[model samples]
Target: MSVLLPPYAEALGVVAERDDNGRLVLAMDFAAHVRGRPGFLHGGAIAGLLELAAIATVQDRLGSDDRPRFKPITVTTDFMRGGRDKRTYAAAVISRLGSRLANVESFAWQESEDTPIAAARLNFLLARATGSPNR
Candidate 1:
């Protein structure tokens, strides 16, 4: 399926592709726009990528027909290490998807999955699409 990312995501050069496990992965290339403090990535950019990954994951799970409108309730992020100037990747795992809410966890890494640079836990309020089947 084709994923239509938001304008900001496009502007940031974020792309969605499947991993070896057939799961969606969001990737961003390091550039001046996302650079910070010489060679590191800006914190805001990393957080944005994480948020987008979470949203994309939820959308993928819901499918186009049953897709719901999402409103972010809260996002708690932890920075483990500085993001270096390189290709950064992020992916989200849906912890829970209820009738009206979703809990998602996302992580961003540069070199390897074992070494994540940042992580975020996000809670979102989901509104069922009009005329859609009830969950």
Candidate 2:
């Protein structure tokens, strides 16, 4: 399956591709635009990447036919380590996709998924159709 990123994600240089194991991966290369502190990435950039990854995962799961508007209710991010000067990759797991809410966990890593530089947990409020159950 393929994913389409939002314009902000595109402007941030986020790309979606498959890893060697065929697992979907979202990545962004190191560039001056994302650089900070001389050789590290800005925390906000990494956070933005994490957010986009979560959104992408949710979008892919919902598919085009079931496009329900969703808004973030909460976003919590943990900076495990500073992002170095290299490409960063992110992937998200949806913990719950309920009738009116969704919970997603996203991680950003550089070399391996085992060692994540950052992680985010986000809760979203989903807006369903008029006749759909909100419960």
Candidate 3:
């Protein structure tokens, strides 16, 4: 089945892929749709990228138990540096997981490990999957 996307993610052109170990890696390119300035990515777009990556990471870890639904109850994003107009990579790790709630943290970088782009914390409501996928 195809992966699902959140509303803001769809607007900013977020893409999700499963790695060899079945982990989800969400990525976004700095395009006109998400450019804050001439070449920098918008802050909101960067947040969306981080948030979606975190959510998808939680979903992947939870397995197919409940159809994989995630709603952000709270999202705190720390904008460290400006996201350059390049292919951005997002990686997320689950901080805590519960039956009804999950907390995830993620980071986005331009290329090198030292060049941090953005960091975020997200709270997700784990329930039955809902809504339609973004097409």
Ordered from best to worst TM-score, the candidate numbers read 1, 2, 3
How well is each residue in 16-79 modelled by candidate 3, as lDDT tens digits? 8766876677878778988987788888888888888887777677666555467678899998
lDDT of each: 0.92, 0.88, 0.80
At residue 116, candidate 1 shows an lDDT of 96
Whose TM-score is higher: candidate 1's or candidate 3's? Answer: 1
In candidate 3, position 10 carries an lDDT of 78
Which segments of candidate 2 are over 4 A away from where they belong?
A: 20-22, 129-135
lDDT of 2 at 6: 78
User: What C-alpha lDDT does candidate 3 achieve relative to the native structure?
Assistant: 0.80
What is the lDDT, from 0 to 100, of the residue 15 in candidate 2?
Answer: 94
- Point to the candidate with the largest TM-score: 1
Off by over 4 Å in 3: 18-22, 129-135
Put down candidate 1 lDDT per residue, 38-113, tens digits, no spaces: 9999999999999999999999998887777778999999999999979999999999998788999999998999
Q: How do all models score by TM-score?
A: 0.93, 0.90, 0.81
- Tell me how many residue pairs clash in candidate 2: 0
Q: What residue pairs are clashing in model 1?
A: none
Q: lDDT of model 2 at residue 44?
A: 88
